[model samples]
Structures are given as structure tokens and as C-alpha cells.
Target: MSFKSIVRELKEMRDGIGSTSRRGGSGSRHWHSRTKSHIVPDVTLAPLEHVQQGQWANLPFDLLVDIIRRVEESETTWPARAVVVSCASVCKSWRAVTKEIVKTPEQCGRLTFPISLKQPGPRDSPFQCFIRRNRETSTYLLYFGLVPSENETDKLLLAAKKIRRATGTDFIISLVADDFSRSSNTYIGKLRSNFLGTKFTVYDSQPPHGAGMQLNSRSSRRFHSKQVSPRVPAGNYVVSTIAYELNVLRTRGPRRMQCTMNSIPISAIQEGGSAPTPTSFPQIIDKHFSPSPAAKGKGLISDLNHATLSEVPVQSEGSLEGLVLKNKAPRWHEQLQCWCLNFKGRVTVASVKNFQLVAAVDPSHNVSPAEQEKVILQFGKIGKDIFTMDYRYPLSAFQAFALCLSSFDTKPACE
Candidate 1:
């Protein structure tokens, strides 16, 4: 009748059943005996209810702001920007919070070109210049649009037409891969631009020895003599060392590109010594191009103010340094499982077709958090055969473009 009385009767019924089960000869009880004796107790307990949901939106504003700041500062991967954007889209409350957090340019990551680049069409919006890579071939076509047009496609097409007609060169730079796989891993390729193509090679001279057997007289003899030994081909050697070289193809002779990785500490290695220490940070260097003989003594001396017309000193090999590369330290990316560079936060995973070229800073010195916030150059994907480069510096557009192109190589991480 009463709540307490009914509860006592249910407990007494349960205890009686337990006592009978324990005294039985067999350990196992029948289905009828196991059945709960109390189907519905006379007592009416409180009805079940749902627990109240958490009030995440009601969290202190300052605490929320701190949480977002930590996330923005720590997330340095490729999808970091996407994660921030996602937070903004969660709800109006979150959106307002994120908006305040990203007000500073440094707080917001650099602009990205998510889509692969495509050739500019007549009606497409105009860009300063366009770098097009052929999908079917390993050729990169550089278009320097001298004529500025409202339409980006028209500008690129016009520039290509004018340069081709004047120089009789298509401005096509073909990348010929040495390896059969044609992947960026290791290859010797010719970067044919204008009429003369430059030869550049990226190869792993000292590959890891663990992956394959070294092809030597001793190993060959051991394999041949042992009937059970598996034959390993000479070509099955792994590359352990990596080197890059560029050669300028000239009419008279092929001159090695006069360049050096500046600011890199030179460590002397003894003959037949251990491997040379690997560079920690990427190096930036100036490339000097020897003046063409034909251009010598051709300048008019009359115009004192005309710097272009004045004869440049013979000793002064024009610095192609503006177009020179500013190499960032290649980092091991765990997600992409590749070696990449964060060029002022513009590029995460470096590729030949996609990379950023920022101003060269001392590698030994760490960049101040405030100074290293913005992007220097944003180059790479917009759509297929179409690429974008948003350069803020005063470097020559061609040189900047070329420097970005140089990054599309096989680095250690790629191997």
C-alpha cells in the first residue's frame, strides 16, 4: 500500500528465491526459478528523465577566445586553415568568436590557391602572370604577359604571342625525368626555356643502403657462387646522397650555373670520411650570369641618366639573384609523409609545380613570431594547367616565378 511497505515485500520475495536456489542440488537453476519474482513493484518510483545537455555556448568569452588562440597558434599542418574555418561555421556564437580572433592578418593564415591552376580563358579574370603545366607532359609553360588586360586570360595569351613572335621561342620548359617512374623521387631533367634549355639534375647519389644490396664485385661473387642466393641486379642500388646542379646551355659551351648555397657553414670532411653533415635549414644563394659577349661594348655612353643604356662594368656579372631562390628548411611532414617547407606559411608540402619563394633571412637566427606571420609569396594550384603566384615583394616577376618553379623537385622526404 505505502511505498516503503511495497519495497520491503519485493526484497523479501528476492531473498526467498536466492535461498531456494542456493540449497538446490544442481548449480544451474531452471528458467522458471531464474525468472524475476517481482515483475512490477506496488511502489511507484520516480519516472525516468533525460539528463540536461551541457551549455557549451555559455562558456566564458575569455576562455573561449583563449581556446581558439591556442588552436590557431599550434595547428601548423596543411588543413589548419580549414579547421579554423570549420570552427567559424559551427554556430553563430562560434562564428562571432572566430571573427574577433582572426582580425589580425598574422592570426589568419596566408591565402591559399586550393584548386590546381588552369590556362586562362579569354573571359577569365586577369592575373599578373600565369604558370601552366601540361597534364599530358612534364612541360611547364611560363607566360610573361607584358600587356596588361582586364581579362587575365587575354593578358597571358597576348604576352605569350608577343614573346613567341619576337624571340621565336615558346617559353616552354620541359622536365625530362631520368627514372622510369617519372616521380619526383630522383631525376635528371632539362629545363628548356626560350631557345636554349637549362639542364638541371636532382639525383640521390647516396641512397639508403638498407632498401637494396650494393652492387660490387664481392656481393656479385657471393651471389653467383651461392646456388640458393637470390640474384640482385646492379640497378637495384638505393640512393643515399642527394645533389642538385644546374647547367646553362649556351652556343659556345654549357656553363655550370654559377651559384652557391650562401650562409651555409662549410665543414671540412677528410678523404674517405663519413658522410657530409646534412644542412639544417635551406640556403639562399645568388646566381651570377656572365654577360653575353655580343652585348659587350654595345651600350651608348651619351645618356648619363640611362642606367640600362650605360655600359655595365665587365667585372659585374649581372645578378640573377632577384630571380634567385630563397630556400626554406625542408621539414618532414608526417601527414603527407614527405619533406616540405613552410615558406612563410604559404606552402606546407613542397612540390615542383607548387611552392612559395620568400625573402631570404638568416637560417641561424630564428624568425620573430610577429615578423614571420604573413606570406611573402603564395604560388601554386588554382586549377589544372593553371597556377597562381601572389608576390608582394619588389623582385623581378620572372625571377620570382623561376624561384617558385625550382621548388618542384624531389627532396629527401619524397624519397
Candidate 2:
């Protein structure tokens, strides 16, 4: 059977089960409620419920696995790929089988779940994404699919709103565009820059690794509101740092920049080397299940309190570092009288923000010449308020988005 047909049958059978449960006595209704209570009431799983005697939920184990495996293989893109997610959400047994069948983005070269945003991109080529900017609100939206026309809409992977402060500037990123507040459950992470905007730090809402929550004294003083969920960590974990070289004199032809991905190791650039990829999401207090709006806000409010107003520290050149990215120099185009880097038609228009990134090799490490030539991430303008961002393995969408947002900031010293 076709994947959609099988999904339709599951839904139709669920309706029958619901009708059966509703017509039964109070005991049957009580049992149905208990079953739903155990399942996470998220967008993916809320539609289906379990029943001990339901024929749909009792499909043969081997057949059920095969069907879902086919669904995963058939539907490979978003909106359509959501069916695969639905198959997993059907029941506990289905979820287990589906999880086993699904592979990480690095392995499959496809984004299948929310956790994929935190995982590495495909190994061979960079995953392509685009950003839409709302100039009036100073917000940026990141989409997974190709660049859509003005009227067309694509899947919004992440959003960020720019906020200026007396000390520095902040870019508040979240899953939803409307609500940019740190007190919202959709809040993911943020980027903070010093007054000059030359240095920026990327913060993750959860730890990059499996490290236990260790709140520093600095963070304790910042978070005045004691109300916070125990499940949520106390402070945002520093993941990476981005820096722009001071170019006030305009001696350089183009802007020079560098980024140190603290969460990724330098060894990742070596052949057959792997970087740390988070397999699952952190324990987030689901806003949908919260008893009250006020209760949900408390847990979400603790994220941005610990940001440092001073300059984000730059890793010393002498110290052993994680993966370092340096901007590829653009040659002066004599014909156009403008700087240029071969974006291969991905970029158009001459904007100072246009640039490509390649891994910087350390003298101590033996790195391949081909690896150094590969463009790990590249960002440039395609239209007004629209841009393309392509990133490869060792860099997640979250990290790539944060890095692109840095280019949007006004760097007085690095113009």
C-alpha cells in the first residue's frame, strides 16, 4: 500500500476507536484517558491513542516495521516527510521501531526531526537554507527549503529578533517568529555582541554535550527571578565565538572574520573523523501541557540572564583550539571594480557581507588540501531582505544561522 494510504487507514481506524471509546461506559472512557496521558501530547503524537484490544494498534510486529520503514524511505522532504513522524507517534511500539529506522542528518543527508537542527549536516555537501528578513521588526526567519517567491511560504526552521541594549546588542532566536521573548517556550538560543559589534558569542539553550548543569557564580547573580523549572538548565552554554577584524582605516579590500566552534573539535576536519552531535533534545517544559501560561513563563525566563556585557573572549592563537573558520579572501574584480568570491551563481550583487568560510588548518595537524578547499559554510545576498545560507557537516543549522546573523550586525570598526 502507498504510504499515504496506510496513514489514512491508521487515522480512519483511530476514529473508529474514538467512537467506540465514547459510546462505552465510564470504565472504557477512563481507560482511554489513561492511555493518552502517558503519550506526549505534542503536534506529532496527539492525534492517535492506544487501545489494548484495537486491531490497528495490534498489527503484526514484522509487517508494522516494514510498513514504517517504507514510509521513511518514500517520503524524504518536509510537509510530506511529516508522515514518517506521524507513523512513529502512533504508539509506543511504533515509535521505537521508527526511531531505529531513522538515521542522523550526517548519515542520511535529510532533516527528519527537531533534533536534526542540533546534529551535523550531510557529510558530502552542504545543506541549503534561506533567510527572510522583516526590516520593520528587525526579525530574521530561516527556512529549510529553497528560496521561495514573495507569496510562497516554506517551513520556518528558526527566527530571530534584534534587540539593542545599552551594553551590547542581542539577537533573540526562537522556533516561532511572533513570540521572541526569552520567557516563551519556543526560545532556542541567542547571539550577543559587544558595543563595537566586533566580537559575538553563540549560546545554546542546552549543553552541547551530556555535561551536568553547573551554574557559575556570575550566572546566579544575573538571574534574579528564582522561579525556574528544575528540568531546564540554569544558564545558556557557550558554543562558539565569532570575531571581525578591525578595519576602520579601510586598508583591507574586504571584511576579514574568523569563528571558533567551541563545541566541535579540530580533529573533525581530519578524514573519517566525527564531531559531537546531540542525539536528542533537552527536557523542555512543553508550553502546550503547562497548566497555566504564567507557569510556563517561569521556566523559559531564565535563559538570557547570564550573557556577558563585556567583550566575548577570543581564543588565543597559541592555545589548542576547536575547528576554526576564516573568511576566504575575495579577489578584486577588475571588470566590475568590486571584490568577488566564486559563489558559483549562489550569490549575486556586491555586498560587503558576502563571504565564504573554510576550515583553518593548524600547523600541528595533518589536514588534507581538499578539506581546506571545501566551503563548509557560505552566505550572501540574493535579494533585498533575502539571503542564502549553505552549511556542511560539523555545523548544525542552529550554529550556521547564528553565524549568518553576525554578518547582519553593524560593525563600526570592521566596515
Candidate 3:
């Protein structure tokens, strides 16, 4: 039937049909009559005009469950979450839909994944609870990536042990291998040999290198160290041989292991207190390690070194500091935030309850507030291209990210 009809029916079901009485109206009481009844005493039956726009959570549990069920099974899934998240902000019913989406299995999934019932639920909090719970109970994939460094081999081994202990089983851990693979193996093997009782399987991840990973380790007993000369054999291990970092794996499963190779610049390494944390990294092309000749081009470089521009130049709104901080990635884009991750493959519709978000643009529109919203609304309708449209909501990645020449072309400059 028509949505209006459905709403009308729902309202009647919520209140009652044909019941009427004198009720408040304008500045005084007024009497109304239903087709099946008369009213002159106390109150009147008046359906809320905005009932259709009401919170889905306020709907009967059975209907809310159905709404959430449809949402979860869709490939673009809802996070097993709660409704009162910011995505609910526009209205009361929108908030209800958000909650219904959370409590439904289509969203919560086969795992009744325990939430820390003590804490207040957060808006767009992310999959932290899911990751933590799976580690404790699920046989999911893991990558034991560690930058090669002074104590990296040992550190990686320790991390594996921790994962194993948390999951209560020794999981097959993998590492990267290349020309340095043999040498790296020797270092890693030394660390693994130190573990006791924890059984682990080792697969030499060479030849068919750069393999996709599964989450579980084979029975530890399957790991047979080869006899090198009689007593010593090739150490059992798995390592990656890829160029990109894919901490890249399914939200679940064993084959999803990835790590960033050690990439500390020589400049930082030799500079001692200057370099960040990693201990080992293959040499990279950069202005220092490998500069492009001026003959090549004024702006061109030999390699994809760090960005030439050094800082974010935009002046942040002081009151907006909290908003930007709340909405932004950390200083170095340290770890991509929840809003930045695109909420997986969820679909985009102009639906009231969408938690699926597009990138938040840094507002740079040097325009009147009306003009800014006009631009923002225009882009908001398309669901992406925030800064290119307006910077108020889609902000700079911090002023530091806005200074580069490439960033100069942004449409509405915030200032």
C-alpha cells in the first residue's frame, strides 16, 4: 500500500480508532468526533502527523527486528551497533531506525559479540569490540608484521605468542621474504625456538610468495624443521613478499596477514634521536636517498618519497578545534579513523537512517554561510566530493595537509 496509508494504519494501531474527546487545541479545548464515536469530555484521538518520521526504535520490537534483519544481510552491511549514534541526529525516528539496525541480526551477525555492557555506547565508535572479541574467541587470520630492527625478530615472535595465547591456540604466523628472506628467517627462527608447549606450523612462503592468508595456524605438530646437516634444518616460517600494506584481509579468516616493511629513512636512522620507532627498512627512493635530477623536471622526483610540502597551512576555527579533532585523523594520519574508513561497502541512499558515510570534507568555502550550505548540500546529495564542494563539513586533513600545491586546487578555500 502507499506509505501514507501504512503510516495512517500504524498510527491508528498505536492509538486507537474512533475514540474522540475534547482535547487541547489552539489556546483552548476543542471537541472532535470520530466516525464511530463522539467526544465532549476529556481528550481526543489525534494521530501524530510526523508518525512516519518517528524513530524506528520506538516501533514495536517485532517490526524493528524485521527492519534490522533486512539491513544486515545486505552485502553493504550495518555494523553490529546501536541506534542512538550521531547518524541518528536529524530526527527522533531516524534515531530509532539506527537502533533497530543495531539490534537486528542482519547487523549484529552470528556472533552475539559481547559488548562491554558497562560503558556508554559511542557514535560511530568502530569495530574495536569486534576485533577484540574475535581475538579472544574466533579463529581469524592475523599478520605478524614487524619492521626488521634490533629486536624486531624477537618482538614479532612475542606478538605471535600473545595472539596465540589470546585465541588459546598457536596460529600459523607469516612474515615477508625476499633476497633478505633467508637472513630474516634465521633471525625469526631464533625467536620461535624459544616458545614452549605452543605448537605452530611453519610453511616456507617462497615460490608461491605473496599468498593470501587464512586466520588459523595448522596444528603446531605439522611444523617439521628440515635437517640442514643432520641436527639443523631450515627453520619453519612464513613471510610476505609484497609492495603494499594490506593489513589487508577479510574482517574474518586466517589468510589476511599484512605488514609495512621497515621504512625508516636513513636520514632518521643515522640521526639517532630523530628517527621514529621502526628498526629496519629497505632503502627507499627520496630526495636524500635518491633525488631526481633537475634536468628531469622542476617538480618531478625519482621516487614516491614523502610529500614535498611540509605542513598544513589552514587556520583552524578555535571552537571548531574539537569538531575537527573529533572528525579528523591524528597528526600524521596516524591510523585512519572510523569516518575515514567508509564503513565498508554499504550503499548510499538519501535515506534518513544511513550510517554509511562519504568522506567528510574540510570546509574551505570563502563564501557566505548560505552559499556554503548551498554548496555543501549540492555535494551532500551526491554523497562524496566534500572539500571540492565545501570545506565546512568536509574539512582539511588538518592545515598541514592543505598546504601542498596539489591541494591548492580545492574549490572553496575555508579562509
Q: Please provide, for model 2 over 118-226, each residue's C-alpha lDDT reduced to its tens digit, 9 standing for 90 to 100.
A: 8889979788889989999999999886675565536667889999999889998876666676654556689999999999999887666532333556554644444
Global lDDT of model 3: 0.22
TM-score of 2: 0.81
Local distance difference test values of all predictions, in order: 0.30, 0.72, 0.22
Q: Candidate 1 lDDT, tens digit per residue, 189-244?
A: 11112222232221121221111223455445543442221111111111111123
Report how far residue 139 has shifted in candidate 3, in Å: 42
List the candidates ranked by lDDT, beginning with the highest: 2, 1, 3
- How close to the true structure is residue 370 of candidate 3, measured as C-alpha lDDT? 38
Model 2 worst lDDT window (10 residues)? 308-317
**lDDT digits (tens) for residues 1-415 of candidate 3:** 5534544444453333113222333212111221111111001111234533554335675664454454334423212221122223223454345434544221232111111110112211222111001234322211111111244221111112122243222332212111122222211211111133222222221111121222223322222222122112223323211111122233321111111111111121111212111111111211122111221112222222211111111111121111111111212234542222232232232311112112222454222333222211111112331111111222111111111111111111111
Winner by lDDT: 2
Q: Clash number for every model? A: 19, 0, 46
Whichever of 1 and 2 has more lDDT, that candidate is 2
Which runs in model 1 stand beyond 4 Å of their true positions?
1-129, 134-154, 157-324, 340-350, 361-378, 404-415
Regions more than 4 Å wrong, model 3: 1-58, 75-94, 97-415
